[model samples]
Target: MLPNLDDIAPNMAGLTIFSILHAAPGFSQIPTQDESKLRTMFIAPFGRSCYAHVPVGICLGPEYFQTKMTECLKGREGCEAVMITQSSTKRH
Candidate 1:
């Protein structure tokens, strides 16, 4: 089950902060054994180039990232409470 922010600190003794992660930054943290799998040619105004990290447009990018993050948070209490689809947080 997911946590509802409305239920958090109903007495106003706590705080909630919202964070949004852009796909590119997270994807860069994941290394590919064969970088060629992540490669894609593109032509921008500056020039033509390819991505060194996983591209945001890839169909599996978001799911793959989410799985990795879930693995990282596995066994931690309140992990599921803080996870909202593509975004996740670890209390520290």
Candidate 2:
């Protein structure tokens, strides 16, 4: 069952949280072995249907890391048509 967002943030919390897997630092920090492990854990199980329904957000980070993550997910067996969204923002 899903947790109640109202309990966490009465006015601002979203009801559901989407997962966006990203490299910790950059592409260099994510070795092939680690990338494969992440894929097996996050992407592989959900497959295409789930991923397609939940948009993947890629924002902030090294250009190479963002590129690599996009490429990896795009290459997944049932994720070839997955949609990727890019975002940018500043906080004070």
Candidate 3:
């Protein structure tokens, strides 16, 4: 089930290649005000004026919810994930 990453590293060639979903872009590698890639790539998915294709990208697994966006996010925030269900209840 996963595709090989061609034109890439040999060791990683056979492994599954997927996208990362980051919120707030975590500990800055470079200041975002200067238009750092860490800031741009994560924010890219939501905008129309800017040309980022992440909105239309594939839903490959391992949705990593970095420490900055734990409680507000699903998928165990950054740990393991289990299938859960919510059932409707009749109000008294």
User: What TM-score would candidate 3 get against the native?
Assistant: 0.19
Model 1, 1-92: lDDT tens digits are 55466875463344354554444478887765465653666889999877766777778889988898778778874554342332224552
Each prediction's RMSD over C-alphas, in Å, is 6.9, 16.9, 16.3
Q: Which scores greater on TM-score, model 2 or model 3?
A: 2
Better of 1 and 2 by lDDT: 1
- Give the top-scoring candidate (lDDT): 1
By TM-score, how accurate is candidate 2?
Answer: 0.21
Whole-model lDDT values for every prediction: 0.63, 0.42, 0.34
Extract clashing residue pairs from model 3: none
Give the local distance difference test score of model 1: 0.63
Error of 3 at 76 (Å): 7.0
In TM-score terms, which candidate is top? 1
Clashing pairs in 2: none
How much is the lDDT of residue 48 in candidate 1?
A: 83
